[model samples]
Target: MEELDVNVSSSEAFGIAEKIVLLSFISAVILMAILGNLLVMVAVCRDRQLRKIKTNYFIVSLAFADLLVSVLVMPFGAMELVQDNWIYGEMFCLVRTSLDVLLTTASILHLCCISLDRYYAICCQPLVYRNKMTPLRIALMLGGCWIIPTFISFLPIMQGWNSIGIIDLIQQRQFNKASNSTYCIFMVNKPYAITCSVVAFYIPFLLMVLAYHRIYVTARAHARQIRLLQRAGNPAEPRQGHQEPRQDHQEPRQGHQEPRQGHQEPRQHPPDQHSTHRMKTETKAAKTLCIIMGCFCLCWAPFFVTNIVDPFINYTVPGKLWTAFLWLGYINSGLNPFLYAFLNKAFRRAFLIILCCGDERYRRPSILGQTVPCSTTTINGSTHVLSFFFCQRRGGGPAAPGLAGQRNQRGCAKVPGGVGEGNALFPQSPG
Candidate 1:
């Protein structure tokens, strides 16, 4: 009897130690999710340069959604995990489940919106992008990201629509000796599972895939064009060197010399620098976003696939498996802040500044310091000021007759005749 007691007590102690480890890990993830997302929001809000880039607006929205997930969803989830029972009652269970779906779906939708924004910025014409991604349009997109998930999350889950055909099974499980009323049971019929998963995950995933694919293609084409231009420009360099002495004689004809100088200037420097910079920016942005998208997929795809599959299989999926996948998805909220800080220089800089208590030494020069020149052009009867580093002009004056206006008020420049479409990929500095 004493031996039995000692063995049982040892097992219990081991179990308690295991539980402590698990709870500690969960708490760390929750804390990281909260602090990391808060930093993302605060960095954007406090940094003037980050605010100027419209793409960061989408990022801010994503962080906000993650922040809510950390605050409203994660703590309760951790509690349920540690307790191994739903102590919060049925109504709160519904609320918690609804919030989890809502915030996560909102986060996925925000990513889709961001991919769309980048697609328009990189793949479409500047005029089209400017028209399509206007402030009002952006605001509408953000609103849709938050609002669209309610149909799948709150409305369905709270109304018992998810458990429609499974009501009997749910009731049976609740009354069974092995289960109890304290368990927060959430089950879905096949139809509800499919509908909810499609709305919340699959559709947005498809859109993001398409958008990123097109962006990849466009960026590759731009890169190829840049390479060809570089090769062609290389041969002209030696020719210019040989012609330097001959320019002494041509100086007498100032008119001819001035035109040649203007033409040669762009061929020598502007196109190469501009195209290279634009290509680098596009590549960097694409890489960063793709990493984010990939992480999101890695984190959520299994849970969603299981979410759709478990219903068809009669919910034979183990409860432990369900918990594992759900918390895996939750970990994504924490992962995003680290992803941003590690992959994006701007975010990293801001993070360092924030962490260091806003030390001036952590500050870097703003992209605004690299301003080129701005020219105004009228497209479809509306005058728009375009900013560019160096205007590639065919002649002495502006590329278009309407480009006679002064520099843009925002201190940004544009290519005179839509020649700097690449520059339009980022209205401000690239994030």
Candidate 2:
């Protein structure tokens, strides 16, 4: 075995003042992240309405990461602030770095997924998006993100993790045992950090920037079209002389002037409202994903540069500051729900409905209190059974079911009978 660098001393990279500031920042970030992500998870789990689509599923996955960071990273980080040196053993250091790498990777991948989702949705490629972005596919991507890096992280520990073969910790314990004090693992190698940044940060980053740029271009086109249409008409009287050829009018609505009357019957198209909403949603969601990606890059970029570039430059900075910045990137997991609500109508509606579920209407007298969506599954053999629970609107007044929106998992609005309210007999996508 290689001799341990136990006695190798590293210069103190952080002062007490810097440590205090970093601790404060990360502590604030950790607390907010925990609450935000917990709210998202609870709302999704309690309300059946949030799980109807791929986007919400991704949101939940991100929340899971945030919860993990809060549980696993924050406390250790706080303790480390007080004790500048690692009191915890090599094992914990390894685990810490591994989890940090994996979770951050997953979060970045989520942002990328969201950007792709937005692109397809806004670009009118629903079938392609739906076919490609399955839950199983997402699960595999997440698995790959975790398993691959963890394998890489443990590679240099004793030997290549692949070469180490299956660890029979059970049997190993029978021989020479590691100390009980070896609970924390942070002794990660530099290769793992560099590789993590490349795969998890740079790749996803470039992809999101490209996707968002395209989305912005497309959205600008749509905005231009909408403006032209708006300018060409009077809500009261239609404008004249600026008309297009008959081929363009498409189902001239029962109202356009007679010149457009004989226009070849415009092709019957899908619902305009639906298409418009989808386009708007995709554009906004893409932008949000880009912003999230930007945040990730900003947080991780400094640490990566410091850690990687410093070796050659022999440059050193405050380790506490760098560590705090790195953890800050993980905060994106908690911000996802807020981003979704801000950028996507479906998510916003889901959040609103879930919030309203606990009201007096549903709680006391009215139709029902606020209710959020949860995943309920009964797996028997090859098939799966899923059901959603609905909560009535908040105001203790009558809820016109129409106002409740489409019922399939998105709405989760149940009538007096088991029947649902909205016309959508099936969810846009299965859970």
Candidate 3:
């Protein structure tokens, strides 16, 4: 009898150690997620350059959504995971589940909105993009990102719409449980699973994929144009036969003018330097955003796939697996801020400035002083310009009479200078 008692105590100690390990890991994740998302929100709010770009508005919204996920959704999830049972009553359980669904769906939708915003800015005409992505329109899209998840999350879960066919099975499990402790079982029927997964994951995934694909194509075309311009500007050799008698006689005059022209022309028409740098920056920003999207998809896809498949398989998926997938999705909330800091120079600077308690060295120089008036209008005290690539003329000069029309008659609307540099998502340079 003493031997049996000793063995039981040893097993209990082992179980307690396991629980401690689980709780510690989960607590760390929760803390990181909360702090990281808070940093993103504060960085965007404080950084002048980040505020100037309209795309960062969507990013701020995304960060806010992730922040809510960390604050509202993660702690309860961690508690339930550590305890291995839902001590909270049925009403609170439903509320927690609803919040879980609502916040995650909103986060995903923000990503889709961001992709669409980029597509419109990069692929459409400047005027068209400006008209389409007005402040009011942006507000509406941001509002929809927050509001559209309710139908799948709170309304259905609260009204008992998710357990339509599984009511009996759920009751049976509750009755047959070995312990009397309550469980927050969020089992769904096939229809609910399909509808929820479709709304929350699949549709937004499709939209994001499509938008990024178009942005990629447009970026590739712009790159090709830059390459062609470089090759034309720098030829292998001068053709002796093509030189006319006028060229031979005027050679000395041209030679005398060459030194002055060479100094001024580079600043005016620096397609090789300015244009190529701008394209490279834009391409890099796009690639970074794509990496973000890929991470989001990777984290959420497993849980959502299982969410849809579990009901069809009669809910045979193990409880541990469900918990693992759910926490994996939660980890994404913490990953975004790290990804931004590592991948984006602007974000990194802003983060450093914030973390260092407003250190001057980490702060980026203000670009507002260099702002040139172009095809942009101020709305609500914020300058909204969609055409980063479009320039007025070389050296910020006004276009000649009928020059705009002639360029419009041809296919080229964007010149090589005058407007801001780089893409809408990032600043012109690291500073």
As a TM-score, model 1 comes out at 0.75
Q: Please name the candidate that would achieve the greatest lDDT relative to the true structure.
A: 1
Pairs of residues clashing in candidate 3: none
For model 2 the local lDDT of residue 396 reads: 34
lDDT of 2 by residue, 128-236 (tens): 6456666788677556645654544444433533212223421222122232222232322345446645776677778777866676665555445434333322222
Candidate 3 wrongly placed segments (more than 4 Å): 1-18, 174-176, 236-269, 339-344, 366-431
Candidate 1 lDDT tens digits, 132-245 = 988899999999999999998999898888887778777554332333324556788889889888988899899988987876676566566556545544445667789878
| Order of quality (TM-score) | 3, 1, 2
Q: Report the error of model 3 at residue 184, Å.
A: 1.1
Candidate 2 error regions (>4 Å): 1-22, 155-193, 234-290, 315-321, 341-357, 360-431
Question: What range of 10 consecutive residues in model 1 has the weakest lDDT sum?
Answer: 400-409
Candidate 3 accuracy as lDDT: 0.68
- Report the Cα lDDT for residue 243, model 3: 56
In terms of lDDT, which candidate is stronger, 1 or 2?
A: 1
Note the Cα lDDT for every prediction shown.
Answer: 0.69, 0.48, 0.68
Backbone clashes under 3 angstroms, per model:
6, 27, 0
CA lDDT, candidate 1, residue 431: 20
